[model samples]
Target: MTRKTVRIAMNGVTGRMGHHQHLVRSILAIRRQGGLDLGDGTVLWPEPVLVGRRAHALDALARQYDLEHRSTDLDTVLADPAVEIYFDAQVTSAREEALRKAIAAGKHVYTEKPTATGLAGALELARLAQEKGIRHGVVQDKLFLPGLLKLKRLVDGGFFGRILSVRGEFGYWVFEGDWQPAQRPSWNYRAEDGGGIVVDMFPHWEYVLHELIGRVRSVQALATTHVPQRWDERGKPYAVTADDAAYGIFELEGGAIAQINSSWAVRVGRDELVEFQVDGTEGSAVAGLRGCRVQHRSATPKPVWNPDLPATEAFREQWQEVPDNTEFDNGFKAQWELFLRHVYADAPYHWDLLAGARGVQLAELGLRSSAEGRRIDVPEIAL
Candidate 1:
C-alpha cells in the first residue's frame, strides 16, 4: 500500500485534554496501530508537531512523547506548506482567534467544544470555514462511548417504543484549594476567563439529546455559583464569578422531555460520576460512561407502596446488563480516526463547524434562560 504522511500542527498540546486525550491516547495510539488504512491501496500517517506558547512545557512534553517536531512559533507552523491540519484544544476565550488564523492560513481545522465563547463567534468561524472550503470538525466524544453505542443499538432495535423522557445526572464535588487542591483548573470558576458549568457541559447535552433522542426545541434553566469563593493553585482566595451548577429542562422535537444537572459542587451518590436514565413505553435504560443496564416492561416488578413497612425488593438487581458484543476503542481516538478519514478520503463527516456552532448556540441560550427565569427557544442555524 502507498503511504502518505500528513503533518498536523497541534496547538495547546500541553493542556490536560490536549496532552492526555488528543496527543498521547489518540494520535500516538494511531501511530502505534500502524496508521489508518484508506482501503484504496493507500494508508495515511499522522505526524503531529506539538505547538504551545511555553517553551519549557513544550520541551518537556516533546521529550516525554519522544517527538521530533516541536514549535513555539504558531505562525511559523501555520505557514508551513507541509502542514495539513490545525487542531486547537486551548482555553475557550483563545480558541476563535487561533482558529481564525489557521483557517486564513488554509489549514483544515478541528477543536474541542463549546467551539467559541459565544454564538456569534462560533457562527463566524463556521462561515469562514465554509467560504474557505476547509475541512473542519468539533469533538463530540460522548457519541462514541460504549454505553451510548449500546443505547443507540437498543433505540434502533425498537427497545424504546416512543421514548418519553431522559434524565442526566453529572458531576462530583471539587475540593477547594484551601484544604485540598482543587481537581479542576482555577479558570473554570472565573466568568471573565470564560469558565462556567453551562458553557462547559451544555454542548455535550445538546449533542447527546439530539443523537439519542431528538432535537432540543427549547430550554429552561437555573444556574448558580454554589461555592462563592475558592482558593487557586497558588493558595490565594478568589471569588467564584461563574456558575458552578446548572439545572436544565429541555423540550425535544418529538415531545420527549430531557433534564440534565451539571455541577462541580455536588456529591456523588450514584453508580458513576455521570449517568443517564431514559424511559420509554416498552422499556427503560440507564447508561453510564462504560456500562448500560436495561429493564423491559415485562420484567418490571410490581410492588405495593407501603411507607410504614420494610421494603424487601431488590430494586437495583431487576435490571439486566447490556452485553458488550463488540470491543470499544477510546472515544477520542475513534473520532480522530474518522476525522482523518474525512480529510484524506472525503469520508462522510457530520460533526462540522456548523454543528459546533449549534452547540455554542445551546450554551448561550441556556445561560439566557437561566438569567431571564424563562424558557428560551432554540432556533436552527441557517449556515
Candidate 2:
C-alpha cells in the first residue's frame, strides 16, 4: 500500500480543544485507524509534531503517545521542510502572531476561531494566506455536528419550505473555581485575555447561521457580566471583566431572523448543552448536539390560550425524532479529515480563511452592538 504522510505542526496541543479534539480524537484517531483511506491504493497518514509553550506537558504528551516530535520553539518546528500544515488551537490572544508566522513560512494553516482576537487580524491572516498561495481553513466544528448535519439534511430536502426564524440556546453553568474548580479556564472570564461569551460564541453562531440557514445581515445584542467575580485555576479571586452572558438578535438574508443566547452563568434547563430551534413555514425542528425532533405542518398541534386553565396537551410527544441515518464521527475529527483531504487532494473546500474572518467580523459587530445598544449591520468580508 502506498502511504503518504503529511507532517503537521500542532501548536497548543496542551490546551483542551487542541489535546482532546485535534490531537487525540482527530490525529491520533486517524493514525489508529491505519490512516485515512483515500482509495486508489493510497493511504494518507498524518504525522503530528506537538508544539506548545509547556516543556513538561509537551514531553509528557509526546511520551504518552509515543510521538516522534515535540517542541516548544515554534520557529524550529516551522523551519522543518517536512511540516506541511500548521494547526493552531492557542488562546485567542496568541493566535494572530502564530498564524502570521505560519503563513509567512508558506505552510498550509488550519486553526480554531475566532482566528484572531479582532476582525482586522483575521482578515490580515486571510489575505496573507491568499498572497502566499497556501491552503487554509478554520475549524467550524458545529457545522459537522449531528444536530446541524440533520438540520442541513432537512434544509437540502426542502423539509423547511421557508426558514422563518432560528432560536439558539447555548452554554451552561461554569462553576466559579473557588469551589468546583470551574469547568472552564480562568482566562475565559478575563476580557484582557480575550474571554467572553460573545467573543467566544458569536463566531460559532455566525458560521452556523451563514451555512445552515442564511447569511447574517445585522445584529443587535445585550452582553452582561453576570458573574462579577470568580476564582482562577489557582483558586485566587479575580474580577470577571468579560461578559458571561450575551443575548443577540441577528437578521439574516432572505428575511430569516435568528436570536441566540449564550451564557456561561446559566444552569442547564434544556436537553442539550446547546440547542437550536428553527421554525419554517412548513414545519419546525429543534436540534441539539446529537438529537433532532421535528413537527411537520400536518402533525402540528394547536393549543388554545386560556387565562386560568391548565394545559392538557403533551407538547413534547408531538414531535418525531429525526433518525441518525448513519454513524456520526466527532465533529472536530470529521472536519480534520476533510481539511486533510483538501490539503492533499486539492478538494474544493468552502470554509477558508475568509469564512473565518467573517466569523470574527460578526463577533466584532456583535460586541459593538452590545456596547452601543443598537443594531449593527454585518458588512460582508473579503480577502
Candidate 3:
C-alpha cells in the first residue's frame, strides 16, 4: 500500500568492493537497474549512509551521491534506529565482527561473499543470524548474469539431457598493481588478509555449479603461485602468499564431474571472457560471458586437433553466438535489486548466507585437500 524506504549503512564504503558494490552499484546507480519482479507493486530504493574510517573520504562520497549522512563511527551507525539494514562490503577478515555487531544492534544484513575468513566463522554467522531471526543475505551475483542466466534456462529446459561434464575456463591477466597501480588491494596478495583465488573464487563456482548442475560432493585441488614476488605502489618487493592460480576437480552428486581452472596468468585469446562448456548425451552447449553456442546430435562430427593447421582450416565453421533476448543490466546491480525485493516484498532470494557457507565449505575442503594430498568430501551445513 505504501512505499518502504530502506536505509542502508554501508561498512567499508571507501574500499574497492565497498566503493563499487556499496556506493556506485547499490546506491548512486541503482535507479537504472531492472529485473526485480516484485508483484505487490511497491517502489523500493535503498537510502545509504556511507560509513568509513575517514570522514573526509565518506564526506566526498556523501556529496557525490547527494546523501546527507556520513559517519566515521560504525557502532553509532549500527545503533541508529533509522538504519534498517546493515550492508558489509569490507574485507573478508573484518566481516564477522562487524556483522555480529549489526545483528546485536538489531539490523538485517546483506554482505559480499566468502562470509568469513574461515568456515567456523561462517557457520557461526549463519547460526547467529537464524537465532536472531533477521533477514540475512550474501552476494551470489554470478547467478544473475545474463550469460549465466541463459545457461540456467538451458538447464531448466533440459537441453543437456543426462549431463556428463562441466569445464570452466576463467581468468585474465591482472595488472601488476605497482607500476599499473594494481586494481585490487595490496592485501589481496597477502595471506593474512584472507586473499587468494581459492578463497575468493571457490564460493562463486560452488554456487554456480550447485545452482545449474548439481551440488559439489567432493573436491581435490592444486594451488600454485605463478608470480611469487610483486611490487607495491612504492616499488617495495612483496612476497605473494596467495595462489595466483588454482586447478580444481569437483565430483557432483548426480555422477557429474566438473573441473574449474581459475588463473590470473592467462592471456585473453577467445572472444568470450569466461566460458563454461557442458557436455551431454544428446547435445552440448558452451556458455561464455555474453553468448552461448549449442551443438545438437544432428550436427556434423567433431574434428581432430592438428598442429599444422590454419585457423580456417581447423574447426572454425561450427560456432554461433547465442541470441540475446532479455535486456540485462550489469550482473552486480541486478542482484542488488533482487536483494531489495527480498527484503521488501518478502520474496524468496536463494543467494543467502547459507548458500555462501556452501562455498566456504568447498574452500575449506579444497585447502584441506591441497594440504593432505587427498580428496576432501564436502560437508553439508545445517541450514
Candidate 4:
C-alpha cells in the first residue's frame, strides 16, 4: 500500500487557528515515526504550503518549520498542480469566498466551523462543493473529546437508561487583549466580523447533542453582551458588537431535554472544563473534558445538607479520569487527521459542510429566538 503524500495549501496560515490547525499539526504529523498512521495500514501525511498575507511572517514560519513552500498569494497556490487540498482557517466572513474560489480551482475544501457567517452562505458553499465534486469538511472537534467519548460509551452501553435531561457548563473568563493577550482572536468580539457565542459554539453543541443523544427539535435562548467594550491588541478600546454569554434550552427529538450555558465571563473554578451532567432512570453520569463519573442505582448515595456537613462532592470522589486512549494530537490536528483518513481510505467522517451549515443555522436561529423572545423551531437545511 502506497502512502499518499497529500499536497495541502493552507490559507490563513498566520492566523491562530491556521497556524495550529494547518502548519504546526501538519509538520508535527510528518515528524512522527509513522507519519500520522490511520487504521488498516494506511498512513496520511501532508505537504503544507504556508499561505498568508504577510511575507515576513510566512518566511519566518517557513524557517521555523523548515518548509520550503510559502506564499502570499492564494490564487497561485490554487492553480498549482501539486496542491490536492485547500485548508481554510480564516475568519468566518472570509470563509465562503475563499472556499468558493478554492472549489472553482478544483481543490478539496476543509475549513473551520460555521462554514460561513449565516445559513445562506453556508448552504451555498455546500452546494458549490457538491457541484464541483470536491471533498468538503468542517471542523467538529468536540465530538472527539476524551470526556465526551467516555460519556458516549456510557450512553452506548445503556448506563444512562431512559435519559431525562442534560446540563452543560461551558465557559471561562477571557482576558481583554489590552492587558493580557487573548487566547482567541479579537474578531470574535465583533459581530460584524462573525463573532458571537451562538455562532461560534452552538454548532458544536448541535452535533454533540444530535450525534450523542438526539437531534435538537427546538431552542429557546438568551444572549447578553456582558463586556460592551474591550481593548484590542493595541490597547485601544473597541465596542463589542456580539454577545459574550448565552443561556439556551434545547428540546431533543425524544423526551430528553438539555440546558446549555456558554459564556466568556465566568471564572474557572470547576472540574475539567466544559462539563456536563446527564440524568436517567437507571443511572447518572457527570463528565468534564478530562474525566467522568457514573452513579448507578446501586451506587447512588443520599446526602443531607448541613452547615458542618462538609462539601457533598460526589463527582470528585466517584469520578475517574478517562484514560487518554487515542494517540497524541491537538484537537484541531486530530480532526485534520480524521479528514485525511476519510479522504484517503473512504472512512466515515461526520464533519461535513452540512454539519457545519447546521451549526450556522443554530446560531442564526438562536439570534432570532433572542430577538423574538420565544422558542425557535430549527429548520432542516439540505444535507
Candidate 5:
C-alpha cells in the first residue's frame, strides 16, 4: 500500500467538541487504524498540526499525544507549504474571520457549523472559498449517524409514501451552574457573545430536514431565555441574554409540516436526548441519534380515545427496530474519513461551504421569525 501524507492544521482543539470528537475520536483514531485506505494500493495518512490561542494548552496537548507540531499563531501554520487542510472547531463568534484568513492563505477548509454568526458572513466565506478554488467542507456529523442514516434509507426507498409531517424533540436540562456545573460553556447563554439555542441548533436541523424529508419553505419560531440567571464557571451569577429554548414550526417544500423543539431547560422524558418522528401514508418512523424504528401503515394500531379508561395498547412495542447491516463508526470519525477521501481523491462531496451557508441561512431566518413573532418565508440563497 502507498502511504500519502496530508497535513491538517487543526484550530480550537482545546475546546470540548474540538478536542474530544474531531481530534481524539476522528483524526487520531484514523492514525491508530494505520490511516484511511483510498483504494488502488494507497493509504491516506493524516498528520495533525494542532493550532489554538492557548499556548499552554496547545503545548500540553502536543506533549501528551507525542504530536510533532503545535502552534499558537494561525498565520505561521497557514504559511506552511506542507499543510493541505485547515480544520476549525472554534466558537461560532470567531469562525468567520479565521475561515477568511485560511481561504486567503490558499488552504482547504473544513469546519463545524454554524459557519458564521449571520447568513451574510457565511456567504462571504463560501464566496471567498470558491474564488480561492480550494476544497471546502463543513461537518454535518448527525447525517452520518446510524439512526438518521436509516431514516434517510427509508425515505430514499420510498417507504414514506407522501410524507405528511415530522416532529422532532431535542435537548435536555443544562445545569444552572449553581447546584451543579453547567455542561456547556458560559458564553452559550450570552446573546452578545454569539450564544443562543436558535443560532446553535437550527443550522443542524436545516440540513437534516432538507436531506431527510424536504426543503424548508418557511419558518416560525419562538426563541426564549427560559433561564434568566445562571452562575458561570467562576461561580459568579450573570444575566442570561440568549435563548435557552426554541420552538419552531417549519413548512417544507413538499407540504410537510415539521415542528422541532430545542431546549436546555427541559428535562428528558424520551428514550433518547433527541428524537424525530416522521409520518407518511405508507409508514412512520422514529429516529434518534442511534436508533431508528418503523411501523408500516398496515401494522398501525387504531385505538378509540377514551379519557376515562387506562390505555391498554402497547404502542412502544409496535414499531420494529431497524437493523444495522454494516458496522457503524463514530459519526464524527465517519465524516472525517469521507472528507479526507474527498480532498485527496477529489470524489463527489456536496457538503461544501455553500451547504454550510444554507445552515446559517435557516438559523438566521429562524431568529428573524422569533423576533417578528410571525412566520417568515425562507428565501432562496445564492453566492
Candidate 6:
C-alpha cells in the first residue's frame, strides 16, 4: 500500500466556518484518523498549510493544532510547487480574485458556496477554471446532512409518493452587540460588505431543493430589513443596510412548491433551529439538522373539526421518529473527504464550479424577484 501526501493551501482559516469546519473538523480530523483509505491499497493524506492575513491568528491556529505550515503571504504559498490544492473560505467579495490566482497557478481549487457575489463573476470563475484545466469545487455541505440523508432515503424508497410541497424554517435571533454580543459576524448585517440573507441562503436552498426534491424553476421572494439598527462588535450602533429576513416561494421542476423563511430577527419556536417539513400524497416528514420524524398515510389520525372543542389529541405524538441506524460524520468533513478523493483518485465529483455558478444564479434571481415583486424564472446555465 502506497501513502501519498497532498498539500492543501487553506485560505481564510481564521474565519468561523473556515477554522471550525474545514480546519479542525475536516482536515485535522482526517489526519488524526490516518488519512482516507482509497480502497485500492493507497491512502490519501491531506497536509494543510494555513494561509490568512493575520500571522498571529495563523500562528495561534498552528500551535493549537500542532501544525507546522502557516503562511501570511498567499502569493508565495500559491506559487509553491508543493501546494496541490487551494481552498478558499474568505469573504464573498475577495473570493473571485484569489480563486483566479489559484487557477492561474495551476492548483486544484475548492471553495465555500456563492463562489462569487454576482452570477457573472461566478460563471467567469468556472469558465476560467475549465480553460486552465484545473479541478474546482464549491461547498454544498447541507446535502450531506444526516437528517437530509434520511429524507433522501425516504424519497428513494418511495415513502413519500408524489411529493407535494416542502416548507423550510431556518434561523434564530442574532443578538445585537448592545447587551449580549452577536453570535454572527457584524459584516453580515451590512449590504455594502456583500451581506444579505438572500445571497447567504438561496444558494443553500437551490441545491437542497434540486437534490432532495427537484430543480427550482422559478422564485417569488420578499426581502426586508426587520432590524433597522444593530450594535457592532465594538458596541457601536450601525444601520443594518442588508435584508435581515427573506420569505421565498419556489416552483420546482415537477410542480412541487417549496417555501422557505430565513431570518436573523426571528425567535425559535420549532423543534430545531432549522427544520423542513415535506408533505406528499402517501406520507409526510419533518427533518431538522439531526432528527427526522415521519407520518405515513396509514398511521395518520383523523380528527373531527370543531372550532369550539378543546384539542385533546397529541398531534406531535402521532408521528414516528426515524431511528439513527448508521453513524453520521460531520457534513463538512464528509464533503471534504469526497473532494480529496476526487482530486487524487480521479473519483467522480459533480459539485463543481459550474454547480456553484448555478447557486449564484439562484441568489441573483431571487434578489431580482424580491425587488420586482414578481416571480422570476430560473434559466439554465450552459457550461
Instruction: List RMSD in Å for every model shown.
Output: 0.9, 0.8, 2.2, 2.3, 0.9, 1.0
lDDT of 5 by residue, 258-350 (tens): 999999999999999999999999999999989999999899999899999999998999999999888889999999988888888888899
TM-score of model number 2? 0.99
Residue lDDT tens for model 1, 213-327: 9889999999999999999989999999999999999999889999999999999999998899999999999999989999999998898999998998988999999999999
Specify the poorest-scoring 10-residue window by lDDT in model 1: 374-383
On lDDT, the stronger of 3 and 6 is: 6
Q: How accurate is candidate 6 locally (lDDT)?
A: 0.93
Deviation from native of the Cα of residue 270 in model 2, angstroms? 0.4
**10 residues in a row with least lDDT, candidate 4:** 319-328
lDDT of 2 by residue, 1-383 (tens): 89999899999899988999999999999999999887668789999999999999999999999998999999999999999999999998999999999999999999999898888888899999999999999999999999889999999999989999999999999998877889888888898998888889999999999999889999999999988999987889999999999999999999999999999989899999999999999999999999999999998888899979888988989999999999999999999999888888877898999999998899889899989999999888776
How much is 318 displaced in model 1, in angstroms?
0.2
**Candidate 3 residues 1-383, lDDT tens each?**
44556789988888877887657865667654532346676666667888888898888888777888879899989878999989888888888899989988878889998898888888888888888988899988888777788888888998888999999989887777666766567677777888888998899999999999999999999887887887776768899998878889999989999999988767877667688999988778888777788877777466677778754433435755567778977677777777787777787887777887888889888877887889888967875
Clashes of 4: 0
lDDT scores in order: 0.93, 0.93, 0.82, 0.83, 0.93, 0.93
- For model 3, the stretches where C-alpha displacement exceeds 4 angstroms are 32-41, 304-316
Model 4 / residue 122 / CA error / Å: 0.8
Displacement of residue 220 (Cα, Å) in model 6 is 0.2
Q: In model 2, which regions exceed 4 Å deviation?
A: none
| Model 2 whole-model lDDT (C-alpha atoms) | 0.93
- Candidate 6, 143: how far from true, in Å? 0.9
Per-prediction TM-score to the true structure, in the order listed: 0.99, 0.99, 0.93, 0.93, 0.98, 0.98
Instruction: Look at candidate 1 and tell me the lDDT of residue 343.
Output: 94
Off by over 4 Å in 5: none
